[model samples]
Structure formats: structure tokens, C-alpha cells
Target: MAVFTVVNETDLAQWMRHYDLGEVVDFRGISSGIENSNYFLTTTRGAFVLTIFEKLTAEQLPFYLDLMRHLASHSVPVPDPVPRDDGALFGILHGKPATIVTKLDGKAELAPGPEHCGEVGQMLARLHLAGRDFKSHQPNLRSLAWWKETVPRIVPFVDGAQRELIVGELAHQEAFFESADYAALPGGPCHCDLFRDNVLFAPAAPGTNHQVRLGGFFDFYFAGCDKWLFDVAVTANDWCVDLATGRFDGARLTALLRAYQTVRPFTPEENRHWRDMLRAGAYRFWVSRLYDYYLPRAAAMLQPHDPTHFERILRERVMHADASPLCN
Candidate 1:
């Protein structure tokens, strides 16, 4: 979500008119994420987000747009894609596949407590259930296969310790993927990147129940057909860990599991391999961060995250093999 491609006001206003969204009052680049060019848009109609795809091709984007539409239609709090006069939810803008989605109200709860974790857990479960009947099929693009292909490309940049960890984890994941335990884990459309920034929270109204509420989950670009258990683990790894030490927050972890189970209970197989799944989640991000760190693209506002953050996370999970946030 950085400004890779600049949009002139004249071009933006012309684009807005096609959606019947009224005059663009103002717009500015959002300089946070690494992949796409995003902008905060203000119009007479309301606030929206403009995303120009940096990697996803036009042919590869409908799955995402349709998935968001499906989730939004199912009462899930997702950013609904606004359609154009041609009735296409996405159209080319500035020679890139672009979309305008209703901006969810609220800010990310970066330092969420148990209640917030619980809310996200519940919503994630609901999203998985809602996506069960979606007709489109797309594999998790950054799954094990990608890791296998990408690891060698980045290993030359790592130190001794980093190299050993990366190699060992890659080997371990390869072996694990061949196991029945991995195969039996439930599969579904998953928000593979559900970190804190991807979720939004609205504060309670003056007369309400007195806490911030989970407003929505956005950033569906990384979503794909994957193990639902992996999705849950990925989420837990991010939402229920202390960043400084990579330690699990037991209260938040427990709350998330408890809330998730209310909608979709974990299978016995999923429960049995929860710790391993945590390792998988950690490994995924660690590899990704390492790749971005060493082989970064040109985005105007880009600073790749520290790969060691998730490295510490993977190391912690490996040490605490006895952890059972939910024993099922």
C-alpha cells in the first residue's frame, strides 16, 4: 500500500465520475504496505480506498474481488467493492488493474487485548464459513511450493545463523507437508494475512457496551484456498504474540480459540498439530520478510520489516513444543 504509480487529479476525477461517486474532494497515497499502490479517497458519497495492483494480473484479480463481494454479502464486515457503470467491480486505471472499495470505518487496534483478539477470531471463523460455497479456486500463492522456489534466491544474503534456521525450517516444512496430519487439516478460503493492520476497530458509541468493536477485516489480496487451521495459526501467531520477545499472550490466545470455536470447532487433527501449525505460520512470514529485505522492489514509501521478528517467533514456538493454547 504505497505510491508506486502516481495519479494526477484530473485522471482521478475522471475515474471517480464513472462510478457515480461524485467529485473527489481529496486523495492521498497510503504509504504502509509493500505490495500495492493505495490511496485514501474522499468524495461526497463517502470514504473509499483506491488500490492499483502491483503484482496481481487482471485475469487473476476477479477471484479476490468476487471473494470480497461474497463475504460482504454474507454479513461479514469486509470492504465491499464498488462497481463501475459497466458493472465490473474492477477496471484498469493508469494501466494497472485497480479497484475502489468502501473504506471500513475505524482504525487498526495494533495493541489489542483479549476482547479484540476474540472478536477477530470470531469474524475469521465466520469468513471461512461464508466462503465455503464460493466457486472460484485459487491455491495460496505463497504456500510451500513458493517457499521452496524462493528460498534459494534469498539464502545468499543471510548470515550463518539465519542460513541454518532458514534451511532447517524449509526442510522441516517439506517433510511436514507430506504427512497425513497436514493433509487432514480443514481447507477453505483464508485471509492468509490477518495481522493487526488488516483489521479495523470502531470505539463503542456513547451509550453502548463500553469497549471497542471489531469493525472489519480487509486486505484480501493474499487470500486463497488453504488449510483453515493454517489460517487460524497464522492469525494466532500475529494477533496473540508479544512482538518484543515473540512470546504468546496466553489470555489473548485462549480468548481467540474460545471465540473461534463458537462458530467452527477445530477438528481433532487440527488440535493435535496446533504447535506445528504455529511453526508453519512463523516460517511463512520469516521467509517472506527475508525475501523482501534482501530483494526489495521499488515502492516510494517502503521499508521492509525485520525478518528476525518472525525468526524469533519460530524459535520460540520450536522451544515450546508443549504449548496447548486450546487442547480441544
Candidate 2:
């Protein structure tokens, strides 16, 4: 979590009063995100996630809240923002946008097995199906034009080999998608960042079907219009495993794709583009990490993550291009 802001009890109480959530009994800052200041608030009412918007503008608050409500209404497992007695989804707290949401129960599935992958795949398919009818029309953040702008900013940060590979990969992806065959691929809203951390899973119970159940989806900051296949590719990159070297895992890929295809079968064109999309997804993260690497970071933070983690994943993806590990 971005630790730049100093949230205090007074700020919490004032924010809660705006929503008429009774007096705040206690609150603790949650340091688990990179873009916002989150606090777990305990009041007479119950526990809730109090988010003070740090990076997003006030104008964008409606879109984020409404999108969460929309997805939740569609049976998507996401944190629905609690409306205040005034019917406001957000309130001002310490000169920053703040909202309270019901805290979802579950832990981050860091090392998801095949069962977890299957559930995630099914949920993504459902998200795509549900999102097709969502009326909102937010601009795509990772569109081709955006990539062109972002790549240049990150080019200087990458090593020689990575820079060369990324440059060639970008051109290849651009040209491949420009073909007529790709013109008709289905387009819809997608959860652009479905990383493992963003997905929460409930634990299995004894004597019951011990399967990884969907918990809640957070971080909609990147949700926007995009290719349905791109979402699939992102999921593959997040869940797939490579067993031989244990460097990459494709088992989750098999489970996820198989489960997803059972619900929404990929067309031949989408099938052909899956590998390319996976490669592109890896590169996308690589670029993002590189950008973060070069950018200035706030000093007050817990366990700063290395941007090169994604870079390593990108290299592994490029090296295994011929393996087509997920095809099995």
C-alpha cells in the first residue's frame, strides 16, 4: 500500500460520520497495496475496508464504485461499496476520497493448485459473460496506442536483450492483430489485472468438497474495454505452472483453460492467438515493472517488491515460446 498518507483516528471517525456508521471503535492501517491507503475499520456496525483514494481523482470515483456495484449485482464476487444513509457511495475524508466496503473473507492463494486454477478460470469466464452486458464504457488502458506510448517510456530501463526481445515482440503482436482474421474476435470489458494477489480463495472444509472457491475481486483500477482473449491470456500467465524446472507452471494453465473452454469455447482464431496473447501479456507486465523500477517510490512502505520479478517471468516466457507449454 502507498504509505504516503498519515491516516489517523480522527480522520476515520469523521469519514464514518459522513456515512452514519456509528462511532469508530478502532482502526488499523492495512499495508497491502501500492496505490491506495486502506484501513480495516471496526465500528459499532461491524468491520469494513476503509479506502482513502490516493492515486485516483475524485471524478473517477463514481466509475469505480458503480463498476463494483454492477459487477457484484451480476454475481461477480467483488467488494460492494456500502452506501451511506445519504445514499452516497463515497465521502470526503481528510481532503481525500474515501469509501467503506464490506470486508471479504479469504486469503491470497499464492501457490494455487489445479483446483484453484479451475475455479479461477470458471470465474473469469463468468466475468466475461457478465461483463458483455455491463453498460459502462470506460476507455481501454492497454490499448494499442497506449502500448506505443508506454513502451517508449520503459525502453530505457530494460537490459539490452530484454529491450531487443520486447521491441521485436511488440512489432510482431501489433502486426499479428492487424490481420483481418483478428478483426472479428469478441471484445468486452475485462479485469485487466487478475494476478494471484488480486484473487482471494476460501479454504477447503473437512468432509466437504474441498475445492478452491472464489472469494472476492479487488483492484478494479485497471478494468476497461479489451479483447476477451486478452483476459484469458492474463489468467494463463498468472495461474499456469511449469513443473520440470519449477520455474514456470503450466498445470494451472491446463486446468484453467479447460474449465474456461467448457463454459465459453474459444474460436479457432482465438485459439491460435492464445500463445501470442500469453507472450504479449508477459511483455505487458514486463513493461509495467520496468516503468515502476525507474519511477520514484514513496519511502514509507513495507517490503518494497522488486520490479525484476516480472522481468524474470517475461524472460521465461520468451525462452519457452517454442515449448508452447500450455498447449498440453
Candidate 3:
């Protein structure tokens, strides 16, 4: 529920007519994302997520919509865009690209234990496998070139020590990717951001036995072609924590990796580079935080998140040799 701008009922009504989703029974701003203004729309027909693209341009909408469709068609649990009566996937609302999605059941897991970690891991691996054949022309935002371009933008904002570390890490990441041996691993589309909040878990009935299930794959805005191993590393950072300082979780990492490997076993080379990939994931978020921290925030009407939180995580990752015990 990231409410950046107010949506008038008239504007919403017009948008709904475009999709013919019936009258909006009730609607309110949702605050679960950073890039868009989302609202849970309850209509006479049913419930849906209405997203107003805040940061994405019109040209980028097709990539996201197609990706969602691709995943949904492949049996990956994701919110598929509900097409309009005219078969259009997007409608202009408040002069922004707007679309409606089926509301998925479940809530974000606030405190994920080992079991939850294992479930998430298995689902992520399945998602990776499902996305293996997706054909998209979009550039990978986490690619080596993107990292190199982003480093200079974030360097000045980071502290001196963190800056040096990032510089060194950048070089290491470059070397890791440039090596001919590293070029032979599996590659495909990946969910670049799989933070805890992005995952959803269904409510369980009292005394009923049930396994944790995955829900909506929201925020596919950052998703694109990337290394499969990097996706695992991002999951480790979100699901793993240090119990001593509440930093990174080791047990959760083990469960997650175990479950992920059960679906798609990692190659020997992928296993060898797992630790480095985890380190790179930590630094990726670190740099993103630095960018947000230093850049002037848009004062329009969006929620501002603290970039220091990720910076703290980055510092904690720097202290460990692998950070993820599961890599072994």
C-alpha cells in the first residue's frame, strides 16, 4: 500500500468502465509497494488490485504485463492482468497507466521461520524454472553493465568505508561475470526483488494442518533477464537473518536452499559461486539504498522509506565470509 497520489472516485470510475469490472463497491489506497500507487478494489463483480504505474513509463508496461501473463500461463502463482472489454491491458487513469489484477489470497509473512523459508525457496525455484523460456527484449537491470553505471551514482552518497567496499565488490562482481567459466551457468528471467513483504501466506484454520503456500508476485517492475543464482541470493538476504544481532538468519537459509535445490539442482559451478552471488545481492540492495538516500525524494505524495535499513544490512554482510551457511 504505497499511496503516492490521491485517486478521485470519478477517475476510478472511468477507469473501471474501461475494464467493465462493474461499479467499484469500495476502494482504498494500498501501501505495500514502493514504485506504484496500488488500491484494493472491491466491486460488484469481485475484488482486484488496481495499480497506477507511478515510476514506470508507458513503454515499460508491456514487459510487465507480458511477464505476468507468461508466469501465470506457466502455472507460477502471480497476478495476471485482467484485460479490458476492448482487450486492452492498460487504461489511462489520472494521466497514468492503470490496470486491474485479481486479488490474491494471503498476507505478507511478518516473521518467517524455517518452514516458511523452505516453502518460499521451493516456490522461487519453481518460478525460476517456469521463467526459463520467457522471451523478452528488456535489459537486465542487475547486469554487470547496469551495476557499473549505477556505482558512480551511488558512490558519493555512501560513507567512505562503505564506498571503498562497494568499489571493491563491483570489481569482484565484474571479474566473476567476465570469467569464461562463469558464462556457462543457467540464465533466465528472475524476480529481482523478493523481499519478505513481497511474499504472501494464506491464513490457516485453527487445528488444521497445512503447508505454507506462496501468493501474488507483485512488483515485477524490476524483474528482467538475470542470473538464476542471483535470485537465490536475494531470497537468502530476505529470509536469512543473524539471530545474535537479528541480522541474517542461517537456519532459514539452509531450509530455503534445500527446498530450492529440490526443484532445480544447482550445477557445481553455481554452487561454487553461491557465496559470491549472495555478497553481490547484498551490495545490490546497498547501492539501491544509497541511490534513494542521496537522491531528492519526490515530494508529490509518496511514502518515503529509510535507505539506512539496507545500508545496515550491507554492513552486516560485509562482516561475514559467506553470510549464508546454506551455501556449504
Candidate 4:
């Protein structure tokens, strides 16, 4: 949610007329993410998030907006897309597609505990289940094919060891993708980017044992149809990892998977390929981070994440492959 396309208050106040929302009380640019221009907008009605598409085109946007609407309809705690006066989910802002969604209630729990992990796991399982019947289909844009195309471009920026590790892991993932087991994995619309920051947590009510509830999940821009196990892997790689050393936290890992399995039991195939999927998850982020750090686009508040964090994660996943398990 970087500030790529600047939106002035004068322009925003004029644009607010398209929606039923009242006068713009306040709005500020959000500068934490890499994709799209996001603003925290508040009007006479309520709070909402405004996003101006940077890379995603109008043709490629409906899948995300529709998916959010579908999940919200299914009782998933996701942001609901607000329709315009003409019943459109989005409108043109600064010559690019833009939309607003209801802002979730709580804040992101960056320092998550076992209970937090459990909540995330349950919510994610429910999200996957909720999206099963969604009609729109779009492949994960940054999955295997994109990796193959991206690695060659990034190879020029790394050392011999880093290049060799990336190339070898890519070959391994290629083989895994070609396997019959991969084909049988269940598929659906998934919140492919379920990092900790994308989730919000509301503090427990008075006298509730201090158990925070999962407020909602956001950032559906990277979402797409993919194996449900892959989604789980991507989430686990973030929520269950020790951030400093890139190792799995057994308690958090167990809590996450057990909660998830209680909702939707994993198939035998998913369990069997869990470790490989974890490796795939780590590899995906590592490649993307390298690309972003080396070849970046100019945008306000766009701080490219350190590429070494995912490199450490990929190395851990590759070296300690046997340590990762689907559940306790």
C-alpha cells in the first residue's frame, strides 16, 4: 500500500460524490506495502480504506473484489467492497481503477502467541472453506511459472552460492509440481498472502480470559485460486516461524495446524507434501524479496524488505526438512 499515485483532498472530496458516503472528514496515505496506493479514509458515514490500483488492471480486479464480497457474504470476517451509486464495485481515480472497503475493527498482532496462531489457523481454514463455491477462477500469479520467469532476471544480482541455491530449489520445485500428487491437491480461491500484518485482532471483552478474536483478514490483492495446502504453507511460514532465526516454533506450529485440522482435516496428500510446500512457500517469498530489493519501483513509503530474511527461511526449510510436520 505505497503512495504511488498521489490523491489530493480536493480531488478526493469531488470523487466522494460517486458513493453514498458523506463528506470526507479525514484521509491519509498508507505507506507500508509494495502494491497499490492505499489511504485510510473516514467520511461522515464511517471508516474505510481507499486503494488505487498500481499494477493490477481493471480486467484483473473483479476476481479480488468479487472474492472479498463472496467471503463477506459467507460470514467470513473480511472487508466488504462498497458499491458506487451505479452499483459498481470500483471507479476510475486518477485514470486508474480504485475502490473502497470497510475498515476492519482491530489492529494487527505483530507479536503473535500460540492463542493468536490458533485463531489465525481456524480463521484461515474457514476462509478456504468459505471460498470453495466462488465461481471466478484465477491462478496464483506469483506461483511456479512466475518463479521460473523471475529467477533468471534476479540471478544477475546474487553470489555464486545464492544463485546455486535458488536454481537448485527451483529445479526441485519443478519436479514436485510435475508429480501426480500435486495434481490431486484440492484447489480454491485462497488468501495467498496471509502474513501476520494482513490480519487484525480485537482484544478480549472484559472477563473473557484475555483471548483476542481474529477481527478480519485483508489484502486480497495477491489472492487467487490455488491448492488449499499451499495457502496453509504460506501462512505457516510466517506465523509459525521464529523471526530472528527462521526456524519453526513447535508450539505455534502445532497450535496453528491442530486448530486448522479441527475445521477442515487435511487430506493424506496434503499431509504428505507439507514439508515440500513449506519449502515452496519460503522460496516464493525469497525470490520476490530479492527482485523487489534489487529492481524496485519508485513510490512513497516503499521500503523494500530485506532479501536475507527469506533467504534465511529458505535455507532453514531446505536444511531441516525433516523437522517440519503438518501437526503435532
Candidate 5:
């Protein structure tokens, strides 16, 4: 969501001509993520997010855009991609592939409790189910294959301990991927990057029974077809872990997993492979953060996440694999 390619108001106003979105009132660069150029765009018609693809090509975009449209249509709370006047989901802007999606209401619940995690769990389950019939077949770009390709690229930049941990973890993942248990796990289109910041929540209305409700999930750029357990692991690794220690918060973890289970029961294979899947989730982010920290792309507001954060997480998951139960 970094601003790699700056879009001025005049440029955006001119681009808005392609849509019936009325005149652009204002737009500003968003600086949280490291991948693409993102901005909050407002027009007379409504609020939207403008994203300029940095690495993803036009050929690879339909999978993501169409997936979002599919989930949105199925009543999932996700940002819906807006079409151009000519009916294309995306078109070139500033010589790069760009598109607009309706901005979700509310903000990220960074410091969440059990109730919040419960809502997230339920929504994520619904998201996975809603995406079942989506026909696109993009692989998770940052999965095992990517780790194999990327580990060597960042090896020279890491210390001996970091190098050893990554190499060993990668080898373990390779073997696990070859196992029948891994193969038997239920698979689907997954939000592979459903970190705490990717979700939004708002306080419940005055008469509501809950403290807050999930506004929506956003940032579908990292989504792909993968094991559903892997998605659950990725989400739990963030939403249910203590920031200081990288240890699972038992109450929150239980709430989240139970809520998700109510929607979609876990398969026996998923239960058997749960711990390793957690390690895999941690490893994925560690590799990516290391790469982004050591080899960064230039963006106007880019801030690479600290690689050590996930290093601590991976180490914790490796050391305390049995410390938390999978679900109720």
C-alpha cells in the first residue's frame, strides 16, 4: 500500500473521467504496506481505494479481481472492485495496471480481544466458503516454491543463526508438502495475508448485542488457492499471538477457532497438520520480511517491516508447538 507511483489530484481527476464516479474531491497516498501504490480516493459518488500494481501484471490480475468480485457477490464483507464505464475491472493508470475498490467502513482492530477474534474467525470462514466456486486458479505466490527461490536471495544478508533457521525450516516444509496428510487437507482460495491490519471493525450500533462488529476484510492482493488450514494458521499467527512474546493467547485463540468451527468444521487432516501449518505460516512472513528488509523496492512512503518480528514468531512456534490446542 506504499506510494510507489504518485498520482496527483489533476491526474486522478482526469482518470475519473473513465468512470461515472463524479469529480475527485481528494486523494492521498497510503503508506502502510510494502507492495503496491495505494491511495484513499474520494469522489462525489463515494469513497474508494486506488491501487497501482507494482509487480503483478495485467495477465495475473484477473484472478485477484475476479476473486474479490466473487466473494463480494456471495455476501462476504470484502472490498468490491468497481468497474470502469466500459466495464473492465481494471485499466492502466500512470502506465501501470490500476483499479478502484470500494473502501470498507471502520478501521483495523490492532489491539483485539476474544470477541474481536471471534468475529474475524467467523468472517474468514465465510470468506473461504464463499470462494469455493470461484474458477480462478492462481497459486499462493509466496508459498513453498517462493521460499525456495527467495531464501538464497537473502541468505548472504543474514547472520549464521538466521540462515540456519530458514534453511532447516525450508527443508522441513519441503518434506511436509510431500506428505499425504498435507495433500489431504481441504484447499480453496485463501486470504494468505490476513494479518491483523488487513481487517476492519466498527463499534456495534447503539442497540447491538456486541461491542464491535467486523466492518470488512481488505487487501486481497496476496490471496491464492491453498490449504484452508494454512489460511487459518496465517490468521491465527497474527490475531491470536502476543506481540511481545509471539506466544498464543489462549482465550483469544479458543474464541477464534471455535467461531470458525461453527461455520466450517476442521477436517481430521487439518487437525493432524495444525502445528506444522503454524510454523509454515510464520516461516512465510519471516522470509518475506527478510527479503523486503534486505532488498527493498523504492516507494515514496515505503517502510519495510522488521524481519526479526517474524523471526521471533517462527522461533516461538518451533519451540512451543504443543503449547496451545488447535480448537475446542
Candidate 6:
């Protein structure tokens, strides 16, 4: 999270009174992401995360805050938003919608092994199934519609070949989404941004061979209604591949799908359209990185990620996909 708005301790401590939580003990800006202004806050009661909405307005926040509440209600491991005495999930702080959620206990498994990937897959399936009955309906903000609109904005910054690839891939994904197979895909509220850093894993007991255990998922601001397959694809494209080479790691990929299938069986159409979904997932991030890289918002500790990383990933997924029973 970036540091877009600075919150003085006096102002923050004053804001803390609305909830039953005690005096603010520690507050520090989180510097790992580009989306929102986030801080790790500790009170006499417990540790929590403070987030100030950067792009989303107060009106647009209920969807995410409520989604997490719903997921927690369904026994999913999510950080439920802390409500104010007035029973609101958010309050205005520094003139932006601000929220606090209980901090999950663990660190992200950035270099996840097959077991970690399996855990993620199972958890993601649970998350998707848990949101099946959520009341709100917000379209995925960065869906195909967004890609179509965003590509033009970033086109002027790329080379001719990169431009052609972006245009061609968009058209490909557009046609794919319009096809009958896409209609067959299941839709639900999805944790569309389940990258490694968003998940947490705690260390196991000293003697055990197992080093870590899944804690919970957070950062639900990117949550949206989208194809479940797209969610799976988004996660696989990150947790099941080599970061340096952009190649699919077969063992991790297989482990991930095997666990995911145990929770929710995939339809034959999903298997047939798996490759296309993977490509679309890659395209989504590639477009986003380009947007952030070329046209960025001002925020402290915000560094635009390299757009070419996902472009390389898109090329690899296009060229070298593995065959598995999940896709058969």
C-alpha cells in the first residue's frame, strides 16, 4: 500500500475513539503496494490495518467492506471490517473513506511451493463458493470493458510490436468472452487480486516438517463480481509460475488445480476453455501494469512495476501451456 494521505497520530488517536479499541500504540505506513494508503495500526485492544481509499469513493466502499463481512460470516478466512459505534464499516478520515480490519497473523509466502499453492487453491475455491449469496452486485472494475478502455490510454507509450500485441490480444479476449463457452463459465463474487502478498501464512510448531499454515486473505478492495474461472486463472498465473522465466511450473500448477477441484468440480467447458482463461488472466495484469507504469497516481513509496513482466508472461502462457486432466 502507498502513502497517499498522511495521518498525524493526534488526528488518528482522536479517530480511534469512535470504536471500542483503545489508544493507538503504533502506526506506520505500509509501503508494498500502489492502490491505497495503508498503515499497520496497533491499539491497546489488538493489531489492525488502516486503509484510506485512494480511488474509490465512500459510496463505492460498501461493496468491498460488506463482501469481507459476508465471507467471514460464511467461515471463510477473511479480515472482517471493524464497525463504528454507529455500525458503519467505514468513516471519513482526512476527507477520504477510511477503514480498519483485524490483522491476519502471518507473512506472505512469496516463493510459494506446491503445498502453498495447493492451500491457496483450496482457499480461493472456498472464497468463491462463500460469496455465492452475497447481496451486492458490482461488476469487475478491471474486466474486459476496462481493458478495452485502458489500452488506448497507454498505447502511445509502447513500441509498435507491443502495441500490436496489446490490440490483438484484446480482440482475442473480446471474441473469447463473447463465445458460448464464456457464457458457460460460472459467475460470482471473486477475490480477483489474490496475489501472494495478499495472503498470509503462519509458521507451524518447531518440530513439524511443515513450516507454515494458511492464515487468511485480505485487501478486498479489488473484490468484484466476475467469472470464477477468471479468479482461478489470475491466481495460477502468479502462484504457479516462475517469476524470472515466466514459465509454468507443472508440479505447482497440478497441485493447485487438484486441490481446487476437490472443493468445486470444474465443468467440461472450463477444461476446454482453460487455456483461453489463462491467457486472459495474463492480459489483465499486463494491461494494468502498463497503465500504472505509464500513467501513475501520486503517492509516497509508490513505484510503478515493470509492464513487460506480464507481457513476457502472456507470451509464455500463449506458447507453452502444459496438458493435465484438469484441462482434458
* Residues 1-328, model 2: lDDT tens digits: 4545677766655556667667778788887786888887787887788888876778888876887878888988888899987898887776888788877778898878899889888888888888877787886677667778888887887789778876887897789679875686787888888988898887766677856667877887788878888888777777774523325555667889888888888888787676667777776776666655675456422444565655566666666666643554
Which residue pairs clash within candidate 5? none
Which residue segments of model 4 deviate by more than 4 Å? 207-210, 298-301, 324-328
Tens-place lDDT per residue, model 3, 1-328, is 4777678888776677777677778999986666788999998889888898877778878987888888888888888889999997887777788888888778988788988888788888988899878887576676678778888987876678778888988888889888765787787888888878778888655676656666656677778777888888887877776534427565787899898999999998787777677777887877766665676467522444565656566666656655334532
For all predictions, the C-alpha RMSD in Å is 2.2, 2.9, 2.7, 2.0, 2.2, 2.3
- Candidate 1: Cα lDDT at 53: 88
| Residue 32's lDDT in candidate 1 | 77
Model 4 local distance difference test score: 0.90
TM-score of model number 6:
0.92
lDDT of 1 at 187: 88
Summarize candidate 6's per-residue lDDT along 1-328 as a digit string, tens digits: 3787899878887788889888788999998777788899998999999988888898899999999999998988888899998999999998899999988888999899998988889989999899989999999999999998999999999999899889998998999999998998998999998988899998876888765678999888778999999999999989988989777788898888998999998998888778888889999999998898888766522666777889998887777555543532
lDDT of each: 0.89, 0.75, 0.77, 0.90, 0.89, 0.87
lDDT of 2 at 57: 78
Using Cα atoms with residue i matched to residue i, what is each candidate's TM-score against the true structure?
0.93, 0.88, 0.89, 0.93, 0.92, 0.92
Q: How many clashes in candidate 6?
A: 1
Candidate 1 colliding pairs: none
Question: Which clashing pairs does model 4 show?
Answer: 1-33
Candidate scoring better on TM-score of 3 and 4: 4
Clashing pairs in 6: 1-33
- How far residue 290's Cα lies from its native spot in candidate 3, in Å, is 0.7
Error of 3 at 42 (Å): 1.8
Stretches off by above 4 angstroms in model 5 are 1-4, 23-28, 298-301
lDDT of 4 by residue, 2-86 (tens): 7889999788977898899988888999877767889999989999999999878999899999999999999999999999999
Candidate 5: residue 319 Cα off by (Å): 1.8
